[model samples]
Target: MASELIPNAFLASPRSVRSSLVSRLLAAALLTIGAIAPALAGELLPLADKAVVLAFGDSLTSGIGGSGENYPQRLATLIGHEVINAGVPGETTAQGRERLSTVLRDSRPGLLILCLGVNDFLRGVPEAQIAANLGAMLDLAADASVPVLLLAVPAPGASQIDPLFARLARLGQVRIDLHAMADTLMQPALKAGLVHPNAEGYRQIAKAVAQSLRDGGALISR
Candidate 1:
């Protein structure tokens, strides 16, 4: 683990994210819909029958700690579609940006579940470069006309999506799930390690994504 903690300035839900519910409640009460609430749900992903979902990210997406049952695998069962796990351990945003084009071409997916960028945080990459890499990936997906559902990957010890992720949703014109991993990583029972989640945690993340798909008007079977 990196000795230096990520400066709180970059944190979206800087707290344990367990407190986000209360924070949002207060925001609502104060009539201020700030970045804390971010874009949890927005435009729906255009999913087709037998839609192929390619989940792209890092070790978390690959089921490193989940004993082979990762979130994408659980999500495939949840949504009744062919979900491809396209995760690589220790991948940074720049690497993901470069690899995404090939994955998008090969997968030819109808929907993309992107849970990336946290690795860049761990490596202390400049925030601007990370944001640029993520933007480029979103552009790639958009160019393919593949709808995306981005899950904001939080930093270790933090529960909510990074603030930059919120901006990406707007720029990419994509729907985002800000709570799934944030909520999952914060719970000790849900974690397999300090950051990665176990099978059950992955299950909950799948459930959350499935719910978002449903809410976004995808006709998911269970």
Candidate 2:
């Protein structure tokens, strides 16, 4: 009887397990959205045809696995604006910080899409340092009066909601939830390698970003 009870305790019904996972994911998403909604309540950012959006990140933003088109390219079509892709493969936040001033000066973009820090996280860089680097980037954008849409990338084994991102959002920064995309990218079909997304996956990411921007009132129809 004791042996039978041990097996029963160790085994869970797949359907019930899936249901519980879905529930948890939904709850996390709701909590994150609720936390950041207030920051998005600001006035809508109107874009002109000539307005430029600078997308800065690592290889994920540089279109590593996609078929020559990345999120920024798809985003440009969705929003009818120019999106300059400024992604460099294997770039750390410190490197990004060093190059950002030149990119900002050259692009002089109306808006900035910042997605970074995955490499830092993977390399065991301290979270506080990562946050500080990102905060400095935000300061640069603020100084230039550039509206920013920050995309939060989760570290492996992390929860769908990130408190660090929530804190930044509360401080008046706009953020897009990328947890769903991260989950999707984990599937073999959507992934090109361990950490990169395929073309279809890239398209889905682009759509998510576009929808988030629209929902956050950061992009208005031209």
lDDT scores for all predictions? 0.72, 0.66
lDDT (0-100) at residue 118 of candidate 1?
Answer: 75
TM per candidate comes to 0.80, 0.76
User: What tens digits encode model 2's per-residue C-alpha lDDT throughout 1-222?
Assistant: 000000111112333332332233323434433443323334336666698999999988998988796888988898888889999999988889888888999999977888887788779986566666776676666657676777777665454534555455434344445443565455668768776788888887888877766765656664
lDDT of 1 by residue, 11-101 (tens): 2223343233223322333332246434433445347777799999999899888987798889888888899999999899889988999
Residue 178's C-alpha lDDT in candidate 1? 74
In model 1, which range of ten residues has the least summed lDDT? 1-10
What candidate 2 gets wrong by more than 4 Å, as runs, is 1-40, 157-161, 178-183, 186-188
Clash count list over all predictions? 0, 0
Q: Which candidate number has the best TM-score?
A: 1
Best by lDDT: 1
Clashing pairs in 1: none
